[model samples]
Target: MAKQTIQLQLSGMSCAGCAKSIEKALGGVQGVTTVNVNFANEVAAVEGDKLNSEQLVKAVKDAGYDASVIDHQQPEDDSRERAQQIQFYKFLAAAILSLPLLYTMVGHFSWTENIYVPAWLMNPWVQMALATPVQFIIGWQFYRGSYTALRGGAANMDVLVALGTSAAYFYSVYLAASLGDHAAHQGLYFETSAVLITLILLGKWFEARAKGRSSAAIKQLLNLQPKQAVRERQNGETETVDVAKLQVGDIIHIKPGQQIPADSTVVSGSSAVDESMLTGESVPVDKHEGDDLTGATLNKNGFLKAKVRKLGRDSALAQIVKVVEQAQNSKAPIQRLADRVSAIFVPVVLLIAVVTFLVWAFWLDAGNYGKALEAFVAVLVIACPCALGLATPTSIMAGSGRAAQMGVLFKQSDVLEIAHTITTVVLDKTGTITEGKPKLTDLEIDLKGVNGVTEAQLKQAVKATEQQSEHPLAQAVVQGIEVEALEQINDFNAHEGRGVSAKVTLSEQSHILRIGNIRLMREHDIESDAWSKRKDELEQQGKTAMLISWDNQAVGIIAVADTVRDNANAAISKLQQRGLKVVMLTGDNQRTATAIAKQVGIEYVFAEVLPEHKADKVKELQQQGERVAMVGDGINDAPALATAEVGIAMGTGTDVALETADIALMRADLNSIHDALFVSKKTVRNIRQNLFWAFAYNTLGIPVAAAGLLAPWLAGGAMALSSVSVVLNALRLQRLSLNHRD
Candidate 1:
């Protein structure tokens, strides 16, 4: 059989449940073997022999959500508008009916008693006259929604609400028409039914608004890329073209303050690009000819002509949108429990309600049918699954929001949930734990007749030689130099993977200053014992040594190394205190990795690992029965980041690093990692607490209401109160503080 794959664009997914709905919808299609729907991206990937995308889209549409083939992606604006219109109409109709129903129940004039109004005008027929259309038109959706859930063998909050309120109002109308003046007005529950639907709709409206805001993260990311660009024409002139139309080898002109339309390479001009939106870097990166640029990064200053390399869905912005969407839509481990409960919740609740009515009316011999009916209403009202429906999403929104505020942007709640279980943290040495760039840490000088040269003179020589080199150590030497009279040399030569050499005039005496590694010194035939001794000492101290040669003799040595972040020690200690094992993974030699690891108090170190081997190291840790989290801040770390149980990227790192990570730490501080974990643990705990309260209230409270300890009026009030309490408890997470405890 030939393999088949079908793609569909889906909508109406506010949480993982929606994704599951889409998956179930597609899974029901004939010949479909698997259905994977990413709610975050609103895309579904289906596989099977003879699977049809059109059939899958129709199935999704029948589930009350908009869907179509993947190639016909709906505009975000149009989707939002449709969602808003549906919600607004439902709210408007519910509100319009609720107002009059409320006034009739508790008004200045006694309409039910017929004191201010005539018997015919105040009759039960009149109330039903006004309420029947309201029930069918405004409240029918809830009833239908409940009916659908029941048929699917699932129970949501709607089932409890629809059954409870509808029974009360419908039973009251039957009593009034049959018993006439002897009928009890108290049994007329039309107002309660109308008001219940209104309140629930109000809650749903607020939920929809909050969900719209939460889901906007992906939309905002998508909006970062410009819609169009000025492509350099064949005649050397530029003509504006749609970004979607851009292809490889097309030269585009990007101006200062404009967003780059596609991932490309600079062919001409120089500029500093602000990549904070994508990379979370505060500083603008200097870009010259040949520098690769990403779509969505702003050209902060200057102008550049770049050849378009990757565009459309292949661009970085589009990839980020896709990842974020997938994460948001994917189910977290905890949500599965809710799904199981919902699958059988309605039938179980209905059975309990029927049994309660029979036990009260027949077994217990309550007053009459009215008493049994009251018990039935009480069971339905008090057994609402609002708390169950609210359990996961409220915690997710609060947790993800708090994480974002703490500089940890979780692409999905699943990542936040998994972070709590991480036992071992595998960190890349270059950027995860330490500043990746080399910086001059030590400088040594030895001269006889010249009296020791000033630090300023040594800096001048190193800086002049390194001005033309892009090597990490050379950049460090250049940054460390603090001399006023450093002059640029006309002739400069840089040897790849080695160092640089240049001639400078010192006191009118021409001397060649060559700066590079030990290999560069040997190649230049520079000799000096002092330089070797200094190099050995610095290396023992976990620093890289750069030999400096002057006129065919080694005159000095500059020590350069990637320094560990200031808060690394404290962060490591905190992680250990929390019962987490800290491990270091690095491409550097064992000596350097161990020396740095010892300083930071890490007991385990994986050294000399190439980029390709980092992911394997992460997998090895997992095989040891450890839940691992890999922390990194480079493109090379992308594979490991994706491989780990949880991937954390430093916010100050590259775009590729941030994109690949499950969680992006906004602050570069290692301590934030500790803080993020702390927040996740606390958030998960809060979710459990909220779930407990929600479940405890329904499990215990429903029995009390059915036992007639509470009136129907009181039961309605209590149900609303329980929902509010659960919401307030979830909000408490926002108040949690993550300051240093020790």
Candidate 2:
């Protein structure tokens, strides 16, 4: 049999349970090989041998959901639709029964008090008539869930409540029908059972809504990519193609103010691209020929003619979608514990409800059958594991959302949990601690037979020679040369790792302007005895020296180096204040790394290390029992990122680095690192507080309800209040501001 692949666009999943339901439903289909559904992207990738899309749709429909094929692809299961239907029916039934039940219990109508025709024709029987069907119809999920848990040899809060409340309502109905009117009126608890079910359902609905909002963030992120691109045909005309249909090497014309539809390399033209959506960089970046551009970022000014380098699943936008999707799907450590407990919770609660009923009915001296039924109801109401069921997911959702708002994207909730414990941070030097681009910072001029070379002449000579080279020092030389009327050079040649040499016509003599380091000056035999003294002074001041020699004579010296980020020192200081040791790791020479580290307040520096050595360094730190966080922004830094306790990738870094990182700082600023750590600490604290309230509410509320100090109706109300309190507390994490204050 030949293996085949199918794709479908799905909808209606609101939680992990819904994803599991859809997976199971599709798995049950005959001839289906495998099914993988990503709830975050609402897409399903399916594989099978000779499978029919119609059959998949039918299978999902049988499981109580709607599904449809995408472009004749396999149909996907939509559990949210089914869940909504069930919820709507539950709310409708509860609403219809609650009105009559409440009126009979509290209203002073003459009919409510009538006790004439038959023993069953009383208030208790009327209440039973209104509530019993509602329990079976609207509250059936709790009963079925409880039964499933019991059979699986486990007990949850649902099992206890379902058994307890169901018994109370059924027994009351029996008493109302069998006993005389007075006994039936006193014994029936139809109002208590119905009210409990109604309130619990309301709580569930609210919880579902909250979860829906939190999970929607990934979907919203996906919507940022445009659906179509204007592809330039070979005939020089443009045609719009679906983004999914775009292939590599396709030339795409991006007009001014339009979003780049795919990650591509600019083949022609120039523009300023706004990458704020991807890197959170505040300023727009100038993109010319040979510059790479990412999809979903705005083209701010000028037009760009780009050749698509990556499309479909390979694009940067797609990678981001995958990262966020996986993060949401990955289970937090606390959630795994909750799952373990829930697996056994239902059966234990059932056993407790049974034991409570027997002890009250047969063991106690003053116990009546009616009172025993009330005890059972109290046990079930108090034991419901709804709070436990919601604890981990709610907190994870709130915490991750809060992190995203602060421009920190955690690839997993466990990262947030682990980040708070980090004791040391390993920072990559270039691009992370300092701006990767080199700039000219110092200049010294000395000349023979001339007073001294003017700054304009030095700049003109450097720019004329350096404009043809792509080296960092050459670019710095070009930028430092501020003259606009400098003559363009011809026959420009760059010697790799040395310098740039070009010929410029000056005063009828062909002059060769050479701009490079000392190595390049030596190769040309240009004497630099006096220039060497000035170069040493600049190097001590944390600058790199470049010699400018014209026609075998040294004219000027230009110093260039990577500038440190303005906020690096402050960020490092803040991290130290928070009790974290700041360490710098780099491939640069020890002198350069130490100079940069010292300026940035970093006391620990590991220099001249290769890319492969970074992970070993992290392991060495861990061997000393330090919980370390590695911050880097290069493809070479990926190994250390995976090895560290938490890997923080700078937003301007490569895709490999971002994907390997545990947390991605969307803004490449160092201050965002401080903000991220602060948010993580607060988030963990908030989660603990929420968990405490959830546990405390049950610990205190259960006994009071079981001891009969609180009425069943009041217990139901209190349960709703408890769930609300947890949600509100989790929401408070979003309000924290990380702005620095004096």
Candidate 3:
């Protein structure tokens, strides 16, 4: 059975330990092949045979968390945002309630003896009353989460929290009940439990805010969709309607200063649309008849009546949002190490806490049970699995989201990891390096051998016959030479790799037209020696020359060329400067390929390659130990793209190219390639730094905490800050100097 990925939105996962339990629960389900729970983003992605969303959610519920299927079409769930608000209240309420107990605590310490403490405030009943709500009510989630984790045979950060705080709270209650009101000033630790929970909540609120900012890219993309559109009726009428009610194929009217309602093609009128939000290009693109108009692009001026091409989630904007969301939710390959440690994290901490309590009471500071209990609580409260869980995912989220805003969409997190490692960039010549649209540069006319036939007659015959072929070169000839269409075109035949032959009636006479290269002229038994030198001249100039035969006699030479993009030379130079070898792959002949290659500064060229053999060339490069990133934008480029280390596809490419590419560039230029590689290098480095810090905090803090060098409440503050620092480090990706203008 093939693996099917099922995505679920998760809640109630406090830290990395919670992720481990959810993974274990989901993996136990039948037919589940893999399960990854991203604690940072709160999404669980499971791959399996016949995976059921309801069943997966139930398993998570059984394991003591919440899960639901994620709906991409709808806006982001506001429940988590509401939860963040509630947590702020919890922290605020706990802090306000703990203030009295904290003041009473200052009375017990000799260093703060100068400070005044009221007898009523220091009463045992008053201290118990203040600490009770902070412990049981404000900190209720920790107990509930601990119960769930323990019932499911797992332990989480909540287990650590409940254990540490409960040890302090109940121990204080026992002392107060036995010692009566005298317990208030005699080593009571009610303030320890209340203040610890407040600090933990404070850390959670900050972490939630940082995680919220990390997903700003997705929210920005979703906000682009306009709510309303002006729909044109079939009776040549127009009315404003909700964009959701409009169907595909509906004609829409766009007014000046309004946004393009949805993805459509303009049928009439023209305008300058600012597509900076989608493609990251600051320039406003001009839209005329037959030009594609993407939804949410602002129309600066002019009126346009366009027919809708895609609606709802099928629109270009929606699809980009989906890609970004998926990228953010997916885990990076580097996170496996963190996951392995998280699986065993809480249990080991529990054992270490137990050892610290015994060793402190028996050996370190023998018979001092009160001091030993503090060491036990310190060890339990300080060990943070949350930082270990968030390290890689937070970096992946912020980095991938920022890249998407700059016109580079990383389809998966692993692709972001591997893209920076490409040593060679193999560029497909036609659409990748040069403009795919070909134009007629030269038309050599000669009717010397055939008398009574004007040059216009031969031109009409060639245009009418070429119009029947779908080849880019043939279409270029038809579009390049604008003329009235012929009424009759018959017996049109296309010869693969040679040219096209067709019989057309022109000037009240039926003529056999042969339009192709030297190979086609030979097959027709026509002599080609006359135009051999001219053909080489055109080919050397990076133009495709096709010879025309009129009634078996040589007529003229027609040359077509796809020009190199203006930024091609500069982009290639930058790629080489980044320590990548530049190679050009093309199906064009050797001389034409060489000429185009020289124009773009590419030293190595693979010319005269068939579409089927493109992947083979990529494999050959890989065999030579070169890690190649193939950049292409056609159906023929799919195989080679899939074979490369990373495949980059232009925005104007066919659907096949976009689907096969690892990174899809919204900007139809090579500069976006530089942007993609730059972001990749930056993102990978960010993940490494985050992982190192998260590991170091846990590794070094555990031993110090075990020695009782820190107090319980102080340890709780450090644990909370660890998760916050990791997320803050990841958000630095938003400050990238994309330099897309170059």
For all predicted structures, in order, the TM-scores are: 0.72, 0.73, 0.92
lDDT of 2 by residue, 1-742 (tens): 7876555556543323344456677887777887755443345556688888888877666554456665311122446556656776687679778766654454333666663334333467567778887788777777765554344344445555576667768777777767746644465677778887887777666655555555555445566788789998889999999877888999999999899998899999998988866764557989999998988889988988999898766777666655554454455676656555545554565566677668778877355877666766776676565665556555666667666655677787788777888999999987788886888787766666543345566567677677777655667767876776357467888765466888876555567778776767889999878787787777677676778887778788888789899888888898889889889998654666678888999999997676778899999999999999999873669899999989998875226226688988877688777877777787778767766776677678666655556666666667766665666666666566655412
Q: What is the C-alpha RMSD of each candidate to the true structure, in Å?
A: 8.9, 8.1, 3.3
Best by lDDT: 3
> Which ranking of candidates, highest lDDT first?
3, 1, 2
In model 3, how large is the Cα lDDT of residue 406? Answer: 82
| Candidate 1 runs further than 4 Å off | 1-23, 30-51, 61-74, 107-121, 153-157, 181-186, 236-242, 267-273, 279-288, 363-365, 397-413, 434-538, 541-581, 598-627, 632-679, 709-742
Compared with the true structure, all predictions reach lDDT values of 0.70, 0.70, 0.86
Error of 1 at 422 (Å): 3.2
Candidate number with greatest TM-score: 3
lDDT of 1 by residue, 1-742 (tens): 8877666656554333455566787789999987766532456777788876677778887765568664422444465457667777886787787666665654323555443434453466666766676666777766766655545445555677777777878887887778765453545666667666666666555555544554445556666768889998899888888877788999999999999988999999999998767643356889999988988889998999999887766665665554444444455677678667755655687899899888888878665776787788777877776666566655665566555445456776788787888999888887768877777798776554333345567577678677777556677877887765368454688764356888776666666777766667778676666676667777778887677776677777778898888888888888899899999997665666788999899999998676788899998988999999998873668899999988888754224226688887756778767866876787688778867887788789778977877656557667666655655566666565555445
> Candidate 2: worst 10 consecutive residues by lDDT?
70-79
Assess candidate 1 and give its TM-score to the true structure.
0.72
Which segments of candidate 2 are over 4 A away from where they belong?
Answer: 1-82, 107-125, 180-184, 253-258, 266-274, 281-289, 300-305, 362-367, 439-539, 543-560, 653-659, 734-742
Instruction: Please say which candidate is ahead in lDDT: 1 or 3.
Output: 3
